[model samples]
Target chain A: MPHATGKITARELIDLQSHLMLESTLVGQFNHFARESTDPQFGQLCQKLAHSRTDCLQRLAQHTNITPIQ
Target chain B: MYQDQVTDKNLCLAVINQLKWSATCLTGKILECEDEQLRQDYMQLLNRTFAEQKEAFDLAHQRGWYQPMMADQQMIGQVQSDTQKLMMEQQQSMSPMHQMAQYQGIQAPQGLNNYQQSFTNPNLQNQSIYVGGGQPYYSR
Candidate 1:
């Protein structure tokens, strides 16, 4: 529980965590969009984005030592 | 590549400005907040924004776009100490029931119910939980 003094406070870590959580949510939304999308290119882009987000989620999990709720 | 840097700088600036505005809004809200917990929440948000501004300033300084005046080290130390004290005080304000709930959370591990129960019970204080190392059962 190292608190913030000058560089990188716990609050900032929490904020980073919050941003990652939002990203995960957005990725889920994109996945749903991709499923519904009729255009192959758009669907492919969404699937690629979802994979990228999964990688980001893994990195975020390593940083925070906490599993994402979803 | 050049365009990327410009875009990044613009994004960083936007984020910094947004944080600054949010901090101002929170500061005003904090002053008007009647509930103690709400006031504390606002203050925490303000502190977070201040931290974000500091980070953005550092990034700008690193890129040689701008330099910030160095803060007094002693003043920073005082602020850190005050924040720690406040956090400790907040933790102390929790009721005994809440404390017990927190304890239960710590003790509730998968597949170690019996082992956890043996160590966590009040009557086992006299008996050494560890076999030989004389270390406490709990790492914390």
Candidate 2:
């Protein structure tokens, strides 16, 4: 069944997935950078961002009520 | 176009799957790092990420969006048998040093079952990773 919460249409869910794809990739890149960086400060900041991606991912998942599938 | 074809459930499931893979990949990378301090930081982050995912899963479940499937007795047995076969094959084909080099600490997370819903529909499986629904643009 296609669910619509008020004005939130199915299109938005697709968009959310697209955004998440970018975000997850970006986080992965950031983590890679954090791992490779020699400077402690830069690495710490990148690591922090990689963590923050989690909260963003969570919000997106909540908004869409994503059906969990591995 | 694709939007019309996409049901709410399909859309939700796609997003959920992507997020699951993302988290797992991040965990794998964290496992690969040798620095203890960095690994600890990532471990903390993974903890937060898992917590948030749980909340989302609960909400999705409540709304009837997320449905987890239990592995049946036969399926479990099949998986065990398959594992044993693979182990034997690995033993026959590879040396211990090669195997150790290849194996990453990338086992599934505790909440792996959360994403293991029995999605048996083939039409659902063939859906592309991206949206826009594989429309024939030239037709227009």
The Cα error of candidate 1 at residue B137, in Å, is 70
Find the 10 residues in a row with the least total lDDT in model 1 chain B: B127-136
TM-score of each: 0.31, 0.34
TM-score of chain B of each: 0.42, 0.42
Task: After the best TM-score superposition of candidate 1, give how far the Cα of residue B67 lies from its true spot, in angstroms.
Answer: 5.0
Residue B126, candidate 2: how far off, in angstroms?
A: 82
lDDT of 2 by residue, B50-129 (tens): 76456545545765878889899999999999999999998877787555444322332334322332323444543322
Error of 2 at A18 (Å): 17
Best candidate according to lDDT: 1
| Model 1: CA > 4 A from native | A1-70, B1-6, B67-140
Candidates' interface RMSDs, in order? 13.0, 20.8
Model 1 superposed RMSD (Cα):
20.7
